[model samples]
Target chain A: MTLTKRIIPCLDVKNGRVVKGLNFESIKDAGDPVELAAKYSNEGADELVFLDITASDEQRATIKELVRKVASVINIPFTVGGGVKSIDDARNILLNGADKVGVNTAAIKNPPIITELMTLFGRQCIVVAIDAKRNYDLKENVNIFSENEKKFWFEVFIFGGKQGTGIDAIFWAKEAEKLGAGEILLTSIDADGTKNGYDVLLTKSIVDNACIPVIASGGCGKPDDMVEIFEKSNVDAALAASIFHYETHGVKGVKSFLKEKKIPVRL
Target chain B: MVSVAIFDYGAGNIFSLKNSLEQAGASVDVITSFDKPNIYSGLLLPGVGNFDPAIKSINENSKTKFQDFVEEDTPVLGICLGMEMFFEKSEEGIEKGFNVIDGEIVVLPSTMKVPHMGWNNLEIKKPGTILEGVDDGSWVYFIHSYRAKPKFDDVITAESDYGVKVPAVVEKNNFFGTQFHPEKSGDIGKIMIQNFLNVCKK
Candidate 1:
């Protein structure tokens, strides 16, 4: 047997509640972070990631409380991301009990923090989250991918995918790994929220270049979508949001389907 | 409830281990060193922090009594870095290990990735160790850069093939160890944790 590919259920948290901007009565108690975490952990999710979208000062303590509650209940690997800028921020999250911390905008603005976090926390616990958008305005000396008579390169974006950094995502991924990041969390802004599927080209490009494990985030709508990404790219894990949060598919059902299709997964 | 304790390295998180241990039916305590007389029915060396600092902490915390626990029949469960420190020395750091078992720690082969950080299946070489109920080829969570190089090959009960014969489970007398973090390893890990606690009860 080989190292199985992971399936991660990502929950968007705002002020300590799992937020999706969409009403899903399917969720028990409507966005109780602790409940959803334990549910996913028991549903055969390989891991769980919570993207803290809350930006207030109170969010710091609230996120820690949610983390502690989630940690107390779930027995799976959990990662908390968003607005982690300094070592103190990471320590607060980790000491309260997060297995890993994912940094996106902050690491893009100041890349040295990746090394710093890795030095303070073990590399295994520091995951550098990269938000990338497809820039069809192909430029010189950038990794490019083409599909359906169109050629484009991925451009890195920061600040919840609202700001463009003008840096190539592929190059930045390698640079982050070089700077001692243990893993890379790659999210495709182009494919996100669009149920079509993940940006296979973007995921494959990053996985091919990254020696560290890569988690493909955004644009996974079904088990088939996961099968497509895993079949086309050797991504170590796949992260999904609304599809799971809204009960479109259960984590165990998705893994069973993938297993039937010959993808190794923990059952 | 039978009592168990985890020796904290002063750095890194042990909440998961502590919580999982509690779920596995034991009262868990976080200890710095073996200063107090051994009240624990079982002991755990958590898989976190760097080797040098962790060993330094372990050294500071009453090695003579801790060594007595290892020499006697107090089941000790070491995970990842916890398992690595049982050897004489490690390539990751300058400090030496407890020399509990005759071996040393070294980095994964250069051909493979430095940190084999993910889920891998164990190829059980010898059974009836701490992994008594564990099935062969069972998947578990692992996150480590260095591996054990034991002087006695028979000490290894199971190993994972990560382009190298990476030892997964090991046992010498009542002392036991796993290179993977069973706390994060889902159902299979639960079985191993339960089995370790069972040994403690015995």
Candidate 2:
């Protein structure tokens, strides 16, 4: 059947607690990860993503526990990410009840991990998460493609956005897709936690190049923001943390608003 | 209690499917072999792997058991990749399917996204027990790249629109298959699981 646009609520969790961050820093506790996950699932959320923001060794055990608890209560598909460094780590998360495992920092450390996870668990379960930030300065010699004529192009980041990969975000998306990634979770580091709006220009660039589904994250302040991304870009899904976590607008409210805008959402 | 033998093909996640079956009031058992298909009232072939590898596992493990299970009039429900295996073959792989039904699995058009992920409404073509009480456009969770295309028109119970008309549900005699995961489709999913269990009770 024709796939409908998805509304996803991202829970950046630390030590089993849901947290929110501004530009990938200044993390603050929001609530329990399991509680929020269950709430989102029941409130008509199309999908849920639980990212263990701080991938510390000590918190690894708790992430698995959180996935198990969340999987038991929710009927919707949910994905788990953060600190997944190996195939065993991905396997443990899926076994513990995560429908998919997101790879960002670990994938950056080793690009082959994307293919490894895809081969072992199937592509549908491997989401290659890319945290990208805008870099305006560019030399005339270096050739890089951007959908927009804007001088700045997005750069990929690693280690929870603390380290830069110097890799072009659009180029990496195509690479990840060729490596058998099921979907691309594209988050704009500049727009993250700002609650302004999504980087429709950035989203459009990648969605045009990548063949798989792309879930646009960051800068989702209002339901109109989601509508704007859908209307402006070809993104398959939209994810936000602050607006949903703080009850700025619940999942149902966002879907209802999108439905009224003539957007195809499962309400 | 309706006992269901869930065929463990050594791939994909069965936790949710098993958990959903238990919650829907059925006794579930994860069986590696198809040796005792008659002991259970129903058989469930849940999958999440490539067609070739999955068929290899089934052929190497319990090929005859599945045929026996179906011949005995035991209710069978296949989900996602499991449903795709019901057909004669698939474009995704070279391995032939179980050939239980007259159909083949074809990939969704390249015009639309490959893996039609997320929830979409089901357009009921012909209502059956599996879709009993389910709304005509009820949303169900789906994450599949290929969908079944049955040979006979009457076999398609329901369809969903992507870029093309993707077959959502198919039923032929005692065999039933769903392209979407009923275990992950929320309340609608739970109800479909319960209905499958009810079919076993009959």
Top TM-score hit: 2
Per-residue lDDT of candidate 2, residues B1-202 (tens digit): 8899888776657777888898878898888776554688898988576788777877787656468666848889999988998899999889998888898899888988878888888999987889999989999988988988888878888998888888889888888899999989999999899999998999
C-alpha lDDT of residue A125 in model 2: 91
Relative to the true structure, how large is the alpha-carbon lDDT of every model? Answer: 0.85, 0.86
**Chain A TM-scores, candidates in order:** 0.94, 0.95
- TM-score of chain B taken alone, candidate 1: 0.95
Candidate 1 per-residue lDDT, tens place, A132-179, comes to 998999789898888888998899998888788889999999999999
lDDT of 1 at A244: 85
lDDT of 1 by residue, B1-202 (tens): 8899998886667888898889877999888877677888899998877888787777777655568755577889999988998888999889988778899998888776557877889999987657878889888888888899999999999999888899888899877989999999888888989999998998
Per-residue lDDT over A124-198 for candidate 2, one digit per residue giving the tens place of the 0 to 100 score: 998999988887776443235454676666889888888887888988999899998999999999888898999
Interface RMSD of 1: 1.4
Consecutive 10-residue window with the lowest summed lDDT within model 1 chain A: A21-30
